[model samples]
Target: MPAERLDKILAHHGFGTRKDVKRLCHKGLVFLNGKIATDPAVKVDIGSDTLVIDGKKITLQHDLYIMLNKCRDVVCANRDGEHQTVFDLLDESLKHKFLGGDLHCMGRLDIDTEGLLILTTDGKLTHSLLSPKTHVPKTYGVGLRDALSEEEKLRYAETFSKGFWIDREQNEDGFNCAPAVLKWREKDGKFTLEGENPALYEAVEKNSSGKSDCLLTIFEGKFHQVKRMFAQMGNQVVYLKRVKMGELSLDPQLEPGSYRELSEAEIALLKQRQTD
Candidate 1:
């Protein structure tokens, strides 16, 4: 990377304005490679040189990626007057670090929906993931108001695979969804698949009297698409939560409204899966 003015770099990192960084330099709070740096205009290599401000080292990176286990009722925006946003869950230090950069969510989840939400400062990666042509798969765990009959399950699966128009009255105005995969969950919280273990049946007999649970994987995102699909079939979606995106799954240990930086391996795998 090219060298930049010390004050410019500090301001870019949200230490403060150029004037504020100059003030900090003059006050002997800024150090460059172990020496006091009083000249704000002095150029420094951000990637190679060490910068310390007020006894704390500043580690600069080209991009930042964060994984947040979102909770219900939180909007996926940077700012909202009426409701709390996902950005509010991040630590204040991180918010200050990327103050001037283009930090945003990869995609949005409804205010009532919960689960995996990704926030990043990498605009290129964000665009690649959100592009309609990418067709990345997103998986959601859904809770229905009532259980589906065996015939209804088979019928709904086929209907979803064939794609349907969301708006029946105004076909031109409505959007058509892409083919999606729908799998019903058995009573033991396992998907009903062929050649399952006999133990699964024992558990099903022990606990099989509740609302239906299923997993839906869709390649395209539409406004309330999952809920609408269920509603069209005369069923109601009581709860919704995203569980996976591409090859990245939400960390099971992460609590609601909590977040952590993505590991280097996870970030690489996410990008790799996009191409695959």
Candidate 2:
């Protein structure tokens, strides 16, 4: 919202380098408030002033927030040597638009993980979201290698709630994980509540041969935390996909490898959650 030089703003928005924007100004291709803007050093209020280039009005936005339904096999990076990155899924125009900004993923998902990934040029928001003090909850839908027995399920839930020490390669003594929530899902996509329906439990038991599904919510992000938690319980996470972070869920309409800008309401909700 602060005033910035016209050439700097143009360069930041991917119009071109400072020299290029100055050239456009000299050519009378750049206009400010309906008048030809020949002084590249002229300062303008981005929020209130209108900028036109080549007869087209240019919207000035200093920040960008993108929600991507990330697909598996894509790394959460700008570049990867052996795999496609999440940024690679973005269109060329978007890449160019934020070229001068620090566009990056707020939080990373493993190569095998899929689902909601946020890319942003707002570094402050990213810091708030990733700060450990925020304790923002992230939910994941998990595919387990094997179904848990009723006793095993109870044990797993209780242990997770109480927190447990898990081995980490960096620390020989390992570390204690924070408490997490676990919920079991029936085969028909309904949550299986305790003593709600014996029929649903039997159905899940019969259908689950070597695989089952559950949802896990954790407040903190650690290296391979979800997979490590399952491994500590003697189970394997065969598949994992993030479904929610804070109050924002992945848009069901967005297919894998597709993305769109977050709405104003969604952006506000994330900021609210960060403070809470």
Candidate 3:
């Protein structure tokens, strides 16, 4: 709620750049509480006042938190070259809701994977969740090799048993990440996948047919970690889905490629969780 220069405040609200803001002010296109304000450097309280630029009312929008049930084939980026980015799924009306900068995905999922993806305008929140120092947990559901072996499961669980740290590649800023936690679960004769010590003959037939009967996974956010882990175990990942991150889960009611704003309580809890 602190006072900020009129031009900077307008730009932050997605009006335009500083130059554009100055032009708006000088041209008498900017108004404060209904009166034309021509001074670009004039200080105004950003959190408590309404602004009008060229007759369009711009209210100070609170930090936005949105969850999108990302669908397959959509890239997890703000801009894309060959595929549709997640932002494409948002309608124009909702797109304008973003006052300034584009929304950022907290963590990424491959174009082939589908599940909960969190988007927010708050940079600090995104950094908190993705930062290795925070140790935020993420859970993924995976479809393992049809004829997965017990030995394969143990290998994934104990790959780093020797306590070695492998650094991942760096980003443009030279920030790198170390390995993350990995674990797995075998669905013992579940409804979706069946195998009750079914005769060896039955197991062989199912294996040859390329049908999986168990799920394998862990709560880790390493780059291509799930797929690579399975590959290391000599099994190819047939399907992958992120189920949870931090304290948020995909709402059962949300459909693929759709999004809704987060509730006030949800936002507060998210910040609180980070501090805790």
Candidate 4:
């Protein structure tokens, strides 16, 4: 589908607000396929064409997929306490643009545990990943108190799929827990698994004897979901890292407290979820 509006395209690129984009369009600052465009309503296919804004080529990354090696004591949100937020690490220009009412985070990761995070201005993409019905999988590297056993894996899965009631008063409504699809893999004193491997399923089930880290996937995004899930397993999550969300992965080039524009392929994956 061709992008029907210039402001939409600009917003998709993590440029700025719709009004701000419209202003740029009216000022002839936006270019379509290299030619100056003055109409905010101009239609263009983001996938096939190259867009340039103010001499900088803009690839309409429909949604942003960010991977942050979150440092301790930082929050994974746009705004928070004295501790810096994940958004604080982004480029000033990107911060100014996405910080506006136009953009938001797809899900929340605790301040302590950090890894892969997906942020975007596209609400539909956010919905697809956050919705319980869609079951978009998210993998995380977890730190545990002791080794995991075969029965623990079964218990973890059972508790995640059914639901657990949390006692904490973090949520105003009530402490209701949501179900998730949980699995863990152990590696070298820490449970680890590559995104690409054949025995990943079995690795999560194998019993290991040691205080180690584990990798797990959760299908739901509730308040403190990952940490709480581990709490139920009698394991404290000392560290956490999200590896994937749907078809998007944290860009290898982006480091801790850093972000970049999403590539064309990643945007296409997000757009594809609009229909399915």
The deviation in Å at residue 68 for candidate 3 is: 1.2
The positional error of residue 127 in candidate 4, measured at the CA in angstroms, is 1.6
TM agreement with the true structure for every prediction: 0.83, 0.87, 0.67, 0.65
Taking all chains together, the TM-score of candidate 4 against the true structure is 0.65
Write candidate 1's Cα lDDT for 1-276 as tens digits: 667788877887887799999999999999999999999999888679999999999886656889888888899998999999998888876775442256789999999888788898877787788888888888777789877788988999999999987764333345787889998876566676455344333322222233237778899877778888888778989887787788787776677888899998889867974632
In candidate 3, what are the lDDT values of residues 1-276, reduced to their tens digit? Answer: 457688776776767688998888889988898899989998777678778889988766646688887878999887889999998998765564344345778788999887778888777788777776676666555666555467865665566332233334344221122344444433544323233223222322221232333333233456776666555456677766665566565665666788898887767756764742
Q: Evaluate candidate 4 by giving its C-alpha RMSD to the native, one decimal.
A: 6.0
- Backbone clashes under 3 angstroms, per model: 0, 0, 0, 5
Q: What value does the lDDT take at residue 199 in candidate 1?
A: 35
Superposition error at 32 for model 4 (Å): 5.8
Local accuracy by lDDT, each model: 0.79, 0.81, 0.64, 0.62
**lDDT accuracy of residue 91 in candidate 3:** 70
The runs of at least 3 residues in candidate 2 whose Cα sits more than 4 Å from the true structure, single-residue gaps closed, are 97-100, 170-173, 192-212
Candidate 1, residue 121: CA error in Å?
1.5
Best by lDDT: 2
Which residue pairs show collisions in model 2?
A: none
lDDT of 3: 0.64
